[model samples]
Structure formats: structure tokens, C-alpha cells
Target: MTTPTLSRRLVAEGLGTLLLVATVVGSGIMADRLSADTAVSLLGNTLPTGAILVVLITILGPVSGAHFNPAVTLVFWIRRDLASREAFAYVAAQIAGGLAGTVLAHAMFELPLVQASQTVRSGAGQWLAEVVATFGLLAAILGGLKHARQAVPWLVGLYITAAYWFTASTSFANPAVAIARAASDTFAGIRPLDVPAFVLCQAGGAVLALAVMSWLLGDALRDPEVA
Candidate 1:
């Protein structure tokens, strides 16, 4: 099969991000509306997000590497798997797509088009959780791609599902996702003021993962067989 053009890749990235964020935000809204219990609501939100991720990654990976997360794109750029200019373009697409996703969710739910989140997700513990969550996410992606490319989608989906319950921040490892979520006021939303810290911790976590993985895997880190 012929490789897709850069424009096609960009479209895939943007579309994937849009769908991912829609899954996250829309599921959150649905969960809240359906359940009075917080745990049940969380469970409802987690499953669809994870499952959709598996589907999206599997379908879009060949086209754009399925990097819905800006953090992942940045990591790939640092590892020289992606060019700097392309990385920037990918990030812009992700952020724009993410915001569009929130808008779409709002439209579906009959909520305001854009509302800053009031949900406070702050504190040192939350920051640490973001770091750990992002670190683990990148590690899973890299390790799975290296050793079992066929399982990368399932590995990522399961990891994020678990991270949602384990982490204080519910594992918003993607900067674009975090930023878009701050525009929402639903169950998955984070305070707008808290977005910068989450983004920083995510970036830090991604960098640390790349460094350690590079050390552990050596040249294998340069080009893992991703699926």
C-alpha cells in the first residue's frame, strides 16, 4: 500500500484527537447523567475512553502514528522519529481537534459551547500523579511497540483504563486533552487554572520516560516497530 501524504496524516491526527476527546468528554457527561454514584460514573467514563482508544490507535497508527497526544508527538520528535516541523504541526492539529471535540460534545449535550471548568484538580499529589501517569503511558507505548507491536493498542488502552483509577488526575497524559478538558465543566473537566501545571508535569514525565527508555533500550529506542 502506498504511504499517505503529509496532509492526510495531519487529517488523521486531527480526526483521531477529535474523536478521542469526544469520547472522553461525552462519556463523562453521559456517566454523570446516568449515575448518582461517583464510582459508577467513573467506571462508565473509563471503559469507553479506553475502548475507543484501542480502536482509534489501531485504525490511525499507520497513517499518523496515532499520536493524539501532543506529549507523545514531542517524545517522538525528541527521539528523531518525527521531524521538528512536523511535530509542531501535529501538536497544533491535536490542540485544535481537541477543542473542537469539546465543542461537539457540548453541542450533543445541549450545554454551553465553551465553559471554563470549575472542578479543582490541584496539589502536589495531583502533579506527581500526572508525572507518573504520563511516564507509565509512554513507557507502555514504547515497550509494547518494541517487543509486541501487535499488542500496543491493547496495552495502551488497558494502561489508561487502570491509570484512570490509580492516578489522582485521572491520567490526562495528553496536553491537548488536558487543555480541551479545561473548557468543560463536566465530570471529566479540570479547572482552567490547573491546566498549565498538568501540561508541565506531562511534558516532564514524557521527557523522563524517553531518557530512561533510551538508556534501557539503546538503539532500539530510535525505531521501535509500532503498529
Candidate 2:
């Protein structure tokens, strides 16, 4: 197979992230409108976000590896699978596209285009949640690439779906997505002030996962009997 141009890969990353964030923000708006119950709204938001992830990753994976998440890109960059320059571009594209996603979602819902989230997602538990969420996300990607390349979409989608419930901050694992979400005042939004810490925790988590996966998935350990 031929290598896709950097331009093409960038487009895929942006478009996929746009769609992913749109689903996240739009579904949050819809869910909030439909129910007053937090659990019900969360469930409504979770399913579409998870479903769109699977769809976007499947369709766009071949084009850009469908990173759509800066944390994921950061991991690949750290691993040297992606160049520093390309990684920077990928992150820029993902952030821009994710912001556009919030715009699109708001426009579709007839809400204001620009917003600042009032939802206060902070504190130690929230920070820890981000770390855990990002770590799990990286683990899923690395493990999937190692053993089940074709199933990566499902792996990511299901992981996020589960993480949204299990994690305290509802698993905003992507720094780009976290930034975009800070622009929204909807259910899925996080306060702008909260973004930096979440991003930092996410980065830390990605790096830690990289360290662990490197040792775990390498030629370090294998069971001949199991094989």
C-alpha cells in the first residue's frame, strides 16, 4: 500500500475528530433536553458517542490511522511512529476540527456557536479520572494494534463507552476533545479552567501507558505452553 500524503492524513484526522466531537456535544444537548435525570442523560450521551467512534474510526482508520485524539497522537509521537512535525500538525488539525465540531453541533441545535462551559470538573478525583481514562484509552489502542488491528474501532468505542460511566469525569480522554468541550456549556462540557489539568493528567497517563505497554507487549514475556 502507498503512504498517504500528510495533507490527506491531516484531513482525515480533522474530519474524524469533528464528527466525534459533534456527536459528543450534540448528543449531550439532545440528552439534556430529553431527560432531567442525570443517568438517563448520561446514557443517551454515551451511546451515540460510542457508536460514532466506531463508525468514524472504521471509515477513517485507513486514511489517518484515525487518531482523532491528541493523547493518542502524543503516544505515537513518543514511540517515534510519528514525526514531531507531523504530530504537531495532527494535534492542530484535531483541535481545530474539534472546535468546529462544537460549532456544528451548536448550529444544528440552534444554540450559540461559542460558549464557555460552566461545568466544574476539577479536584483530585477528577484529575485521577482523567489519568485513568487516558491510560485505558492508550492501552486499548496499543493492545489492539498489537493483536487485533481490525477490531480497533470496537476496542476504542467500547472502552470509551465503559469509561464514560466508570470514570468520575465521564472520560474526556482526549486533550483536543477536552479543549473543544470547554467551549461548550452543555452536559458534556468542562470548565475552561479545568482543561489544563485534565490535559496534563491525560498526557501523564498516555506516557505511563506507553511505558507499561512497551514492557508488556514487547518480546519480554510469552507462555510456550499457552502457545
Candidate 3:
């Protein structure tokens, strides 16, 4: 098969991110509207996000490596799997897709087109959780690439599914997702003020993951996976 052009790869990244965030925001809205129980709403939010992730990654992986998350893209950039210029494009596409995803979800739900979230998701505990959550995410991707390339989608889906409950920040582990969520006032939203910190911590965690994975996998880092 011929290589996908840069434009096609960028489109895949944007589309994948759009769908992923739409699932997150859309499901959260549906769950919140349908249930009084926060736990039920969360469960509602988690499943579709995870399921869509698996689907999106599986379908778009070949096109863009399915680096729907800017954090994930950063990892590949650091590994030289992608160049600095292309990584920036990927991140820009992800961020734009994420914002559009929020708008799309709001439109579907008949909510405001643009909203600044009042949902305050901050504090050291959650910030630390973001770090851990992102770290684990990169670890999953890196490890799965090494031993189970075919299972990467499932690995990421399962990891986020579990992380949603375990981590205080619901494993937003993605800068694109986090920023997009800040545009929402729904159950899945985070305050816009909190997004920068989350993004920073996620970036830190991704870099940390690379360091640890490089050491842990030693010579195995010789072959870096696309996503």
C-alpha cells in the first residue's frame, strides 16, 4: 500500500480526536441527563469513551498512528518516530478537533455552542493523578507495542476504562481531551483554569514514561511503534 500523504495523516488525527472527544462529552451529557447517581453517570461516560477509543484506534491507527491525544503524539515525537514540525501539526489538529468535538456534542444536546466549564477539577491529588494516569497510558502504549502490537487498541481502551475510576481526574491523560473538555459545562467538563496544569502534568508524565520505558525495555526500545 502507498504511504498516506501528510494531509491524509493529519485528517485522520483530527477525525480520530473529534470522534473520541465527542464520545466523551456526548456520553457524559446523556448519562448526566438520565441518571441522578454520579457513579452511574460516570459509568455511562466511561464505557463509550473506552469503546470508541478502541474503534477509533483500530480504524485510524494505520493512517495517523491514531495519536488522538497530544500527549501520545509527544511521545512519538520524542522518539523521533515523527519530526518536530509534524508533531506540532498533529497537536494542533488534535486540539482543534477536540474543541470542535465539544461544540459538536453541545449542538447535539442543544446546549450552548461555546461554554466555559465551571466544573473545578484541580488540587494536588487530582493533578498527581493526572501525572500517574498519563504515565500509565504511555506505559501501556509502549509496552503493548513491544509485546502485543495487534492488541494496542484493546490495551489503551482497557487502561482508560479502568483509569476512569481509579484516578481522581478520570484519566484525562490527554492534553487534547482535557482542553476540549474545558469547553464543556457538562459532567465530563473541567474548569478552563485547570486545563493548563493538567496539560503540563500530562506532558511531564509522558516524558517520564519515555524515560522509564526506555530503561525498562532497554534494547527493546530499538523499535518504536507508530502510535
- Candidate that scores best on lDDT: 3
Q: Of models 1 and 2, which has the larger TM-score?
A: 1
All models, RMSD in angstroms? 1.2, 4.3, 1.1
Positional deviation of residue 41's Cα in model 3 after best superposition, in angstroms: 0.3
Residue range 1-227, candidate 3, lDDT tens digits? 56688899999999999999999999999999999999999999999998999999899998888889999988888888888989999999999999999999999999999999999999999999999999999999998889899999999999999999999989999999999999999999999999999999999999999999999987576443355
**How do the predictions measure up, each by TM-score?**
0.97, 0.96, 0.97
Those runs of model 1 whose alpha carbons end farther than 4 Å from true positions after fitting are: 224-227
lDDT of prediction 2: 0.90
lDDT ranking, best first: 3, 1, 2
What TM-score quantifies how close candidate 2 is to the native fold? 0.96
How many clashing pairs per prediction, in order?
0, 0, 0
lDDT of 2 by residue, 1-227 (tens): 67689999999999999999999999999999999999999999999999999999898888788999899888888767788999999999999999999999999999999999999999999999999999999888888887877888999999999999999999999999999999999998999999999999999999999899889999432211000
